[model samples]
Target: LAKEGEEGAVPGPDLVAAMAEQFAESANNVIIEEVNKGLNPGMIVLLVVATTLLLFFVGNYALYLYAQKTLPPKKKKPVSKKKLKREKLKQGVSAPGE
Candidate 1:
């Protein structure tokens, strides 16, 4: 294939046919071996992936719920800038005359 590219030759019909046959034979052998082993590697991999994703989603949801329940509720307060300034001025004021 490398020599073919160097020779400026594109894969013609015959080359395509031969390559297809070679790939098909290899694929058939792989399928047969997997069947003999009685364990579909592809299905196992897919199952593991699905299980991992499910666990991740469930775990995150559980953690979110747990955090919400354990955390303290915030106090409701009506804030005002004037109130804050008054508090600061109060802190700065002197008590008796010098």
Candidate 2:
């Protein structure tokens, strides 16, 4: 039931649901239908390839994250004199001036 935005429209019949019902009622007792019930060679190969690639990428990313957490911190770089002087000035260590 569509709530009152009223293009004065009744809900249209769902064609997809109608099609699915028609297909489900199909009595196509073909021998090929029985073959599709089991996994095909192409589908098995695709599944194996997909699973392998997924594991490889996920394992690599997991190892990278593990290394990030477990590895020692990098050495600190030396601060430049300009930044140091600015910091000192901010801390009110001024030179002798008006």
Candidate 3:
């Protein structure tokens, strides 16, 4: 079903943050329940480490993508005609147009 009016609008940062917090809380509760239900300690450690590394890599890649999109392109510094002419003159080379 489609949402109507303000309900269909994009969620702002505050709403997004709250939703994320709530989701995290629920995830934590689930983890805690699994621990209480005799989840292996080694399994928990592995899961934590794997999740951290995955998130780190994904976040790093996302930042690289954002930087690529928002940053300006590298510019080249061209040699000016005046500088080129001076260099040529210092080398005893005469200008063709002169």
Candidate 4:
């Protein structure tokens, strides 16, 4: 009876160790699978956003360059203080000092 009870008892240390190892392998596989599943899409989204921002800036810069090329050069009329005083005098305006 005693031998039969011992034989029918729970598994030994080796079986327990094997079971623990299998459980660890399964847990590792699950962790790896989850990380892979999450990482791929996350990286894709990040790349898309980064690419969009890069293209946006590049396109804006291109448009800026195009506008600069197409626009006419600005001409600034040079006016001296003497010219302004002469014009004011012509318009019958008094000078600063009486």
Candidate 5:
């Protein structure tokens, strides 16, 4: 069945076929050119390095978070006598020296 358009005539099957063939030929040419050139080694190396660095950082960060969640809390260091006295004074307790 022939399609009717505002112009009173639609594109014939032969014309459509020819247009499709031309488009396919151009697309094939582009594909062939890309295949011939292949991938850029420099770009591939850069991508590999970037991906390695990204994964390394991500793995380290994930490990850090896991450690924070799973590891025991650190023991507090012993306070010096002077620091203890200062803390006591801050809490309104007089130092032993008066």
Candidate 6:
């Protein structure tokens, strides 16, 4: 009967403290597990963003090169020293000397 009484004795404060500690540790482990489970989705999102930026830059570069190749060449203007001097004189501008 003494053994049974000892077994049935209410837990002391120390025992209660130990139980609380174990509960806290288990809760922490559960939270960590949940975070770990979400890691894969975070990595997938990172990969998708990187891929989108890469494609955008590549397409922009290709379009720029294509435009350069397809556009017509610009016409060259002929320069005349007499015309330039006349225009500058009319505009009240003068070159280095008379």
**Which runs of model 5 end up more than 4 angstroms from their true locations?**
1-35, 89-92
Q: Who is ahead in lDDT, 2 or 3?
A: 3
Q: What TM-score does model 4 achieve against the real structure?
A: 0.39
Tell how far residue 47 is off in model 3, in angstroms.
0.4
What's the alpha carbon RMSD for model 1? Answer: 9.7
Given candidate 4, what's the lDDT at residue 63? 97
TM-score of 3: 0.41
Better of 1 and 5 by TM-score: 5
For candidate 3, write residues 13-83 as lDDT tens digits: 88889999999889867643334667789999999999999999999999999999999999999999999
Where does candidate 4 clash, by residue pair? none
Task: Summarize candidate 4's per-residue lDDT along 11-85 as a digit string, tens digits.
Answer: 768888999999988986764433444558888999999999999999999999999999998989999989988
- Summarize candidate 2's per-residue lDDT along 7-88 as a digit string, tens digits: 7556446855887778877856445634456888999999999999999999999999999999999999999877877887
| Strongest candidate by TM-score | 5
Positional deviation of 36 in candidate 6, in angstroms? 10
Number of the candidate with higher TM-score, 5 or 6:
5
Candidate with best lDDT: 5
- Show the colliding residue pairs in model 2: none
My TM-score estimates for the predictions, one after another, are 0.38, 0.44, 0.41, 0.39, 0.52, 0.39
Q: Candidate 6 lDDT (Cα, whole model)?
A: 0.85
State residue 17's C-alpha deviation in candidate 4, in Å: 31
By TM-score rank, best first, the candidates go 5, 2, 3, 6, 4, 1
Alpha carbon lDDT of each predicted model: 0.82, 0.80, 0.87, 0.85, 0.90, 0.85
Clashes of 4: 0
Candidate 5 per-residue C-alpha lDDT over 1-98 given as tens digits, one digit per residue, 9 for 90 to 100: 44566465778799899999999889867644335676799989999999999999999999999999999999999999999999999999999979
lDDT of 1 by residue, 42-62 (tens): 999999999999999999999
